[model samples]
Target: MSRSHIALVGKIAAIACIIFIVFCICFYKTIRTGFIEAQFDRASMYMQGEGNPQDFKKAREYLEQSATAGSDNAQYMLGVMYEKGQGASQDFSKAMNFYKQAANKNHAKAQYALGSMYDHARGVPEDHTEAVRWYEKSANQNNPAAQYALGYAYYNGIGTTKNIDKGLQYLQKSAENGYVKALFYIGSLYFEGKNIPQDTKKAFSYFEKAAYKGNHDAQFYLGVMYENGNGVKRDYTKAIYWYEKSSKTHSSAAFNLAKMYKNGLGVEIDYNHAFELLKRAANGNNIQAQYYLANFYDKGDNVPQDSAKAAFWYDKAAKQGDSRSAYRLGEMYIDGRGVNENFDKAFQLFQQAAQDGNVQAQLKMATIYFKGMNTPIDHNKAIEWYQKAANQNNSEALLALGNIFDQGLDVPKDQAKAVGFYQKAAEGGNVEAQLKIASFYLAGTNLPKNPAKAIEWYQKAVDQGNIQAMLALGQIYEQGIGTTEDYQKAFEIYSKGLSSHNADLQYAVGMLYAKGLGVSKDIEKARNFLKKAAQQGLVVAQREYAKLDLSNQVQDPNMQTVISYLQEAIKNGDAESMFILGNLYLNGNHVTKDTKLAKELFMQSCEKGFENACHILKTTY
Candidate 1:
């Protein structure tokens, strides 16, 4: 070829070669695009069950291949497959990975999915900030789920500073987008007054919407609103209807309904229904329901009483520091009712109860210390507990303290202190204290001799059925100490006192009968009364019984008694009996005389503060 023609041919050949290269590149691009499209189409077909045997496994495989080829939609689908285990094993880690890829590409659904994963800490450690970032991105794109999530984060301050106004703004925006979760969240916020002014009407409206959509929590809350008359008229039937609806899915609603049934508050008493509901709640790990169920078993009010079952529940509650359960365990240990009787175990449980401020336990500890029952007597500790109970206005503690001072049992003898305590107990309307105050006045021991005051206090005690007070009133009337001498009134009072089963009262009655003060002279009645009193450690009755002459051979029962009254008196704390018995020993009235036995008896009576026996022991002996 000519030089110019050869150059033109080389240029044309170069242009042709360049055109072929461009066509080949376009052809290779088309084939690669077709391959990726085919992979994604296959996944879509399997997902929709449009071709082949609607296999999620095949769909996952195709979706995985497409996702590996950088298809954002395919990646999102793959993530959903992994999340739901649709043809693949449920793998949160892999699901999150695929979702992150699509989320990075600004895929709305993927962004929401990844945000939920972070919100719930499903896959990785919960990073709320990351979740909020993705949610906001998708929410800005008008994704309804993302909008609801962003609102939740704002309302709860999950990943950002809490802003009630902003939270409600975002939630309202999501609700406007037809997001049901946003509506539910708005209801919660309104109900709790967190991100909105408390508006029960608005809350109930939103809750009704979510509840209608089968949200168990919303249904439960709506039931509560109706039951409590919040933003609605209280309707037990409607409340029960909604609670029944929620109970199918929510355990708390079942528990609340059970309580209502058990108490007959909003429903008829139905122990059987309550028990069934409680069992459901307990299975759901409702702690309060567990405690109540245990109590039912323990008391057998509605079920068979089972101590073992009670211990099971008590053990569960005790681990949670329930004081009532601890107290029950203590009682069990103390009495060996359902467990082994162990004082140490009881003490430990009682200590736990005391720490919880149980007043009865404090009193129990005081009694244990005071009586030294199964433990050593600790007076100081007893005083400490008594003081504790006294501060709580314990009636027994007040009376005990008064007695301690009056008789000097544990503390030093102080009539002033004794009067102070007795005054306290008397002010509390203690009958015994009223009578004791009356006695102090009658005897002129602590207060000045004031018969009027004595009679007034005695009348108060008499109103409380104090037999001693009646006897004292009778004496006052007989002696004209506080009132005019009325023999008939005194006789009536003494007759009433004598009818009591109390040993002291019976002895007082015997004296009145013997003296013919209350009723007509009846020697037979006097002996019978004296015999009853003698069995109760009354020294005077024993002395009177010893004086009765049983040697007479008479037809009457009084003169034909077999036992000597003197022998009965000698068994009691009678100084005269001691002298008589001593003399009997000295003179050998019924046996040989023993000088040592006589001396010993005189010394014993003398040491017992008997003046006559003391004189005999020092002089006659």
Candidate 2:
């Protein structure tokens, strides 16, 4: 070959080599593109049921391979796969790792996922403060979820000072991005009047947007607003429709729907469906749902009564510090309704309830101490416990304390203090205290005599079933103490009093008859009522019965009855009975005039704290 031809051939060969290298580079780029596209295609096919019947397992494998190759979209998809355990072992840590990787590449969904992981402590220690940092980073990048999360943190004071204004600003920005959750949260803020001038119209607008996006909580809130006419005009049909929509997945919404059905508020009453819905809510650990379900089981309200089931739910709520549950548990233990009778357990449970500020429990503990039932009597402890309850404005406690002071049970008798406590309880609407307050005035013990006030209080008590108040009214009308005497009204009142079980009431009736206060003087009726009162050991009645005329009165068989009645009354610490018995013996009218027995009875009455008996013993016997 010629020398010129050889040089041209070498140059051509070098050019050919450069062309081959360029061709190889283009071929490699095509293969790489195809490989990535193929993985994406496979993932999409599996995800969409186009291949392998929508197998998450196959989709995850394709997504994992592409994600490992540094594809931001694939990394985001892989994070979701791991999060949902799609064709893989559920791994929040792996999901978070993929999310963080994609987030570093400014993948919007991945940024939101990483922020949520930090906020919820899923696959990492929960750090709302750190979550805010990451969320702000993504929010600056126009990530809707990050913006919404940042808004939530600000509104709720989560790792930040609550700033509803700033929260609404960020939330509105996210809403502009079509973030449904942001709209829902902002709507809730407006509806609840949280740190914003409440705007129910704007709230309803936001909620409607989120509800259209199929956000369950937003739907539930929309239903609530419609039901309550808070953000919308009252519309039961709209409330029921939205509630049914939300109840499909939300147990709380289901519970609300059940309540509506139970009360016929927005739907036809359907107890069967209501029961099913409530059970779902109860299973979700809704405390109010559990309480209502337990009550249904306890009462057999359209369901089988089951005390055990009632106790089961009550215990569940009690462990969560529900005061009413604790009280019910105490009752169950005390009564052995759904558990073994255990007074000690009941007492402890009652203490727990009382510490939680349950007035019923406090009063119960006081009554136990005061009555010494199943425990030793502790009057001081009783008073202390009652005072604790009374400070909470418990009328029963105040009345019990008033009575204790008035009767000097364990404290010095103080009518003034008694009246003060009674007034407190009376103002608290205690009918018993009202009657006692009136009695203080009528007897002129604590306050100045005020007949009008006495009658007023007595009338209030009578309206509350106070028998004594009724009898007192009868006497007032009969004697014209506070009003004009009315004999006909007095007879009617005395008749009512006589129908009661109080022997003193019967004696009053007998006095009305004996004095001809209402009816024509009827000796037969008078004697009959006196006999009834005497049988109840009334000392005056016994003396009157003994004074009845009879031929051979000394030898009359009724003398023996009088002596027996007087002896029984003396044994009951009646001072007048002792005096009358002593007089009988001194006159030799009964029992052969036994002076020693009379002296013994007199001394016994005197020692029983009766001053009249002491006087009789000193002067008569």
Candidate 3:
């Protein structure tokens, strides 16, 4: 009962002292936490005006007190209040200081705020490296925004040495966390093959993921990929679906969808739908859509033909540097199709479009300058514009240049240069140029005569259905110019020209039948062909048609029909028709004798240079 009892009493006393100290520490911490929370609550209430007047001054005071007491949330709030100048003078430096304090305490939001300040030089010296440092801290804690920022910095070498692999790795992490922008960037990198092997399939997959999350850009890309078969089989149906989805926000998507609808791709042709889509895209400021929409209004393709609407759309596209639209609008101004005719405005627009390298506009400029359309004619300017357009291999421009040189219009005649331009135009598929070149070779004009070359160029024009070339070729063959005469070939060429219904060609065929040069001699056939030529007001044919009856020694069975045909020719001012009809009336072969009418017809024909009619009038009267 002596030493053991004293030791047990001392141990009990020590255990009681430890328990009292622990309780005092816990009570003190609880009170401090409650006080900080009360301060923060009051600050929030004052800032938000909870049942009281909003007092930013009082809110800042309470937030400062709470922040000083080591509250990370309070520190971040104080930074915002200082930055915004809520009841205090705005001080970025002060805001940055508070953000730094909270950031150092491992507050993710504060770390991101500090990163943005450094990145954008907001309240701090611009330092991408420092920004990356802070962003990394927050990113490591799974902050999607910070992760994206850090990835972008690495990818662009903004804050660190460029490391595409590392950047993609961080971006993938952010994308996995559902960051829409991160997904889009990653997809773009792969799609463009920037600093990495192009992986369209992978890019498409990532874009699809973002598209499903309502990213308009991603949706547009998905449409492009599907339509072009970039990484998969081309699927117009799917492409249209994606394009329609993105068309609300993406003008390019709307334009593409409109084109698809217009071309009947992956759907039934619906011009009305195409028109609506084009209107949407044009309103969104798409240059191509505006241009095509103008064409639709001009042509009455889907909408009622509206010249005013065409001009409006053309003007919109022209302002955006569309050369074709500018040229078309210029044309409208000149024609007064939609607006009052204003040649000055048309000239100005044409000049603008010509300078922009529109081939048609350059040609128009040449024409206007040469013709002096609503302005003084300047042949030099016309030549300059023609040269410009010719330089672009415009066939019509080359043909125009040839004509200018050949005609010596405002320039010394240069037949060699004219032939050169004609040759160029012919090679470029200008049928008129081909015919001109052929004529040059045939007539030995401005160059050594070459029949083979003539035939070659003529054939080129003939291939394009040039009736003049066909007749020329037939004449060449029939006359045996620098070649053996081939009547059969001449007949074939003349037959091709028959579709033109040209009086000369019809007479030529009649002569061939009469002489049996290119066809069998048949008087009936010759008479029929000559009759057709005579009805078309051919003077030589009408004279020959009248002489044929005297040579045949047999009156035509259809004398009244011949009289009617001659009457029609006379109405067309054919002197030969008047002379023949006058002779018929005097002879009374087809009608009762009327000497007075016959003398009047003879006098009319004599006035038109019919020598036989004058002789008959002088001898009979």
Candidate 4:
């Protein structure tokens, strides 16, 4: 009875154990499937706002759960969210971790993300080798971004030796996959012709593709190509179109547009429109625009001359390391034109611009040091700055050096050094330097006299429309100093100076007419020439006019006017006029006889070196 009871109980116990094990297995399978499905469904719903409002917090929670459940898509999404702070605080470490997890599972986007993180040193030390490795892995899986990244790395030799062929191949793959940046890069490579054969047609094609996809850089480059006729025929119309599009975001495009408007390249020359575009570019922090706008304001070139506005734009460009703008601003400070007078500030700005190789600034610094502007005079410093400017072939600086050497101002006088500097400046087209060189040669005072050389330099100055040079050249021709006497040439040279309204040229022309040296002597022409010189207050011309007897030839009113003009000239200390009036009084032609007055006038004229008056005085008194 005990054996049968024990065997039945053992069989029942074994059946119970087997049923319990089967039930536990079924429960585990149902719960695991339900948990994974629910996590994924909820993450997708929160991420895409499907059937609910998008909630980053909820999305992050569900994505984390799904990622924990081994969902590669969820891991990649979590990486993006963490990186961009979309569904959580921005955490590069978390982003890297999630990206690594998904990347291990062969997720292309996650691999690309990991590559970018390594490339930029986000959440890790920069490792270009690691970045290239990840990019290659993702690129092999047909990831367009990764393909572009790998191509750039090859092109730039980021992690390996540069290979243009491999770089272009990878870039072509990315472009085929519709990567806009890759198309732009390929266009730039072709356009720049660096490490690749120049192919404008190919560049234009790639640029067009990216530009149509709203790539601002591609559009800007397309404008540049059109404007420069590099990748297309020179077409300002097309350039304007592309530049307008890119100018929405690119300041350089705006700057180029302003130039086009100013020069009428693509549009009618409209200074106001150009100014507007320049302002826009300057507001966008374009350094060149800032400098040019400052110049426009400073010079009142189509804008009101507002010193404050000029200073503002100059400061903007100067801060960006524009040497010309810095120098201009320094000038404004020194002259209190557009800024408060601050010698110290001006010196600082001049020094900065001088160091930046601004020739004008170097000259200004030399002048400041030499003149002791807000500082002790420093001749050595002045010499240093002047030499710097002279190295750039600045004519003014050379002229200053010549003056310093010739005058022996703070240095030993050296006429040879002065002549050398003057020659250099003359070659650089400084008219004053040419005059100085001519004087040195003509007078034989500073160097060996060479009238031929003097004539050559004088002619150079005359070519530049220097009145003094013209007069000197005329005198040389009249005196036969350098070449054979040619009265006709002398007359021509003197005639050229007539346009300058110089009194000396007028007097010379009148004398030529009176003497009949160049043309047939005509009394009317001589009188007209003398009248012109007299009107300009030439004493000799006034004296010559007074000597003419025009009481019957000229009307009484005209004679009175001439007499009054001569009297005025005498009052102004015209020695020749005094002599002529003394003769008139002595002859009693136009006034009551007064021998005392006539003698007094003769004495005054004789004292001022009137040779005729001196002779008359010696013969009579």
Candidate 5:
């Protein structure tokens, strides 16, 4: 009993000593942590000038003390200060040290900061995969910024193979955690709908969230959605409201608001406010706003015409690689409207825009090179630019190329290639090219003489009000060139051109009526048409009108006039005119009696199937 009691007492004493020692150690740590927290708080207050004037030097001293005492928050803050050069000269290497200290304790923001250092190569070789690994760690701890970084990396395949669905999931998580950029970016994806099904309502929802959270782009899009009535009821008032909010910081939003004021879309037409807002947007480097502002000045639409101001804005936007603006500035330079005329400068600008894929600028470059404007003629460069524009389906450029090949203008004549370009231009709605292709089809020049194709292309031109095409199509039907002689089709086609006062069209229509070819033989219509054609001095119509007098249709007929008409008609091989003139000679009605002349005229008329002349020749002769 004595041995057991002594052993138990010793054990109790030893147990109490261990408990007391452990309590003392825990108490020491508690007091030290409290001291460190106070030091960190003082440092934050000093840095932020809260309740005192800011003193970066004092803040750094306090932060260093707290950080050395193993406070993760203090360590992270000191890291930011060193990394950003806040309290002293920047030292990313030291920042990396403090950030590692805090990150080792699983501080989410510190982990994110460490990832950012590696991501941006701050005191470390840039390593996106390494950044992504840390981002995943912080994201697992529900750090919204880390989640956003991870999502962006996945979205763009920066650190891992691209996975839109996975990226979208992480972005959704970040947005749910109130990351404004993630909200806005996700909203854009829904709005664009290129890789996903378009869901405007869903996009509006995300944008609304981001807008309220101070995302200017989201605010601008909200205005757009409201104004366009996309995924929402049309409410210009709400649109203007959102636009005004975003316009404070976003140039595009200001530009849109300016348009609403200018056009009186949902607000009073206020040119003053419109101009002010437009200038604001333009000065802010909104490319479209700059272009429109330049146009307003150039055309004097709303403001005083200031060519210099227009050129200024155009130059601004052109420097930003706006093709349309570059081309416009080139024109101003060429015409000396805003600056001293400099063709070389203009051509340089044109080439800039042409290289940027502006179809009009491409065509202009082609024209400049082809015409040797401000430079030696360079058909190769011209062809290059023309082909670029033609590739974009520019009808003018296609037609020009066709003409180049067709006329052998500084290039070897290639009828086959010319036909190909002409066909392309015609398909692009170039009326001249349509007519060219039609003529080719009709004449079997470069293209087969397919009447159907000719008629098809001619009709295309006719629909565009081309009188030449109308006349050509009319002649095709009238003369039965490569097809049946469709008099009715010919008459209809020619009638359309009568208003154009074309002598050929007038004569054709008259002949059709006089011969009872298309419409009924209306002598009055036939006479009116023949008179109009004759007044226009058509040689063919004059001969035909003279022959009409053999039917006794001319109102003021005289013997001399009648004799002259008959002589002209005989040359045209008219049997009736020959018989009438022969009778006049036999009777000496308009000339001295001459049986030999009369007999010769009668013989010619009889051989040409004039029954009356044949009867006279056999019985009276």
Candidate 6:
């Protein structure tokens, strides 16, 4: 062969070798891309259980392999698995790590997940600003969840400055994307009217949209609106419907539904159903439900009496900062009703409740200090607590203050201050304070004499069935002592005490009938009433009934009984009884007619200041 032909053949062979190497590189690239795609698809299929029984373990293994091969979807799935503990124990740190890997690659769901972790302090300390940064990145890519979170942050000034306009803009975008939470949040904003102008029609529209999408909070709000007729016709049936739907998961909704059943609203009262619903709400940690359940157990209302359970529920509510429950538990502790008596624990609970503005607890604190029941006597502390309760317009506290000032217990006697407190308490319908203020005004003691004011206060006390006040005010009206005589008013006031079993009231009413001072005169009625009082051992009534019996001139052999009654009256210092006895002896109506005995009785009657006897002696003798 020629030298030129051998050189050409070698160059062509080198060119052919270069072309074969290029083709092999292209073929390898195609196969590698397909392999990566296959790995991602297999992992996704396992995660979704597309053709086999669900196996989170297998899904997680496949996901780890694809995630290591740089698949963003696989990284996002692994983040979810770690977050939810589907294949292993939940670990927020691992979840955040995987989320960051996918988020760095601009995966929208992963970016949103990372934002939620920062927002909620899942693995790292919560940082609203950082959460907003990630949320903004995802929201810009039209992620509905991210848009809702960004809107909420803006509306509450959580991460960014509060801007209602921008918040509403983002929320509307998310709502348009069918995000139920955004729809519910916008409705709440309108209903609350704090950050935005309240529009109930708009609120109803948004709430209804979210409710149809099965948002429990939206359903609960719809129940409230329907029950109250807020931007809707009041319909208890609809309210119950919404409440039943939300009660599956909403504790407050369960409580409200229980109340409706208990109250027979739009349904027959079903106590059994109400009780079951209340138990469900209580187990769900509803604070109000716990408080009411405690009350039911404490009072034994429709349930077996169980003081221990009552105390348990009360303790639960007290731990949640319920002042009323704290006060009730304190009462049980101090009285040893539900638990062993512990004065120190009771005092501490009372102080806690008092500090939380419980008027009854404040009164308990004041009484403890005033009486030195468990602690050293400290009138200054007592006064401070009493004033705290009085500031809430508590009548008992006001009356207590009046007594303290009037009696000079802890300070110099201040009649003016006492009267001021008494007046306030009286105005608040306290019977004891009304009596105090009335006595002060009637006697011109520490107050200018005002008959009208005295009568007004006395009448107020009498209206509350105060026996002492009723008797005093009735006398004033009948005798024209403080005000003009109004026999009808006197009779009305006295009539209220007729059934009190009081001897004084019975005698007074009898005298009214005898003298026709109030009602029409009826001798028979007078005698009957006087007999009733006299039987109860009233000296005055005994003397009066004896006189009534003698006036009827009854020829009974039991004359000694009437005479003995007059003698007993005279012995008790009723001077008028001497004159009546003297008259009886002179007339000899129910006794022997003896002038010597009659003259002796008249002398005694005159000496005892009986003017009728003196007149008989001067004229008839």
Whole-model lDDT per candidate: 0.79, 0.82, 0.89, 0.89, 0.89, 0.88
How do all models score by TM-score?
A: 0.58, 0.72, 0.72, 0.85, 0.75, 0.84
Q: Model 5: per-residue lDDT, tens digit, 1-621?
A: 699999999999999999999999999999998899999999999999999899998999999999989999999998999999988789999999999999999999999999999999999999999999888889999999999999888888987888888888898899999999999988998899847789999999999999999899999999999999998888999999999999978999999999999999889999999999999999999999999999999999879999999999999999999999999999999999988999889988998999999998999999888998878899888999999999999999999998899889878999889889999999999999999999888888888788899999999998887888888998889889878999899999989878888878888888888888878887678767876776665656666776675466655644565466567668778787677778878988648998899999999989999999999988997
List the lowest-lDDT window of 10 residues for candidate 6. Answer: 550-559
Ranking by TM-score: 4, 6, 5, 2, 3, 1
- lDDT by residue (tens digit), candidate 6, 1-621: 888998899989889988889888888867766666677677667767888767788888878887887778888989999999988789999999999999999999999999999999998999999999999999999999999999989888998899888888989999999999999999998898967888888898899999999999999999999988997899999999999999979989999998999999987899889878887888888889888888888998778777888888888888888989899999999988779999999999999999999999999999999999979998889999999999999999999999999999978999899989989999999999999889888888989988789899998998898988989899889889877898878888888988897777888888888888779987777777887888788989998888777774334425777888888887777768888888878888668887778887788888988888899999878
lDDT of 3: 0.89
Question: Residue 317 lDDT in model 2?
Answer: 75
lDDT score of residue 136 within candidate 4: 98
RMSD of 5: 8.2
lDDT for position 84 in model 1: 88
Give the alpha carbon lDDT tens digit for every residue of 402-439 in model 1. 77777876679888988887877777788888888888
Q: Which residue runs does candidate 4 get wrong by more than 4 Å?
A: 1-52, 163-165, 197-202, 268-273, 303-305, 444-448, 516-526, 547-577, 605-614
Q: Candidates 1 and 4: which is better by TM-score?
A: 4
How many pairs in model 6 have backbone atoms within 3 A of each other, for residues 3 or more apart or on separate chains, i.e. clashes? Answer: 0
Give each model's clash number: 3, 0, 0, 0, 0, 0
For 351-386, candidate 2 gives per-residue lDDT tens digits of 888788888888888888899969998888888888
User: Cα miss at 133, model 6 (Å)?
Assistant: 0.9
Candidate 3 vs. true structure, TM-score: 0.72
Report clash pairs, candidate 2: none
Off by over 4 Å in 5: 1-27, 55-57, 194-196, 233-235, 450-452, 467-621
lDDT, residue 459, candidate 6: 88
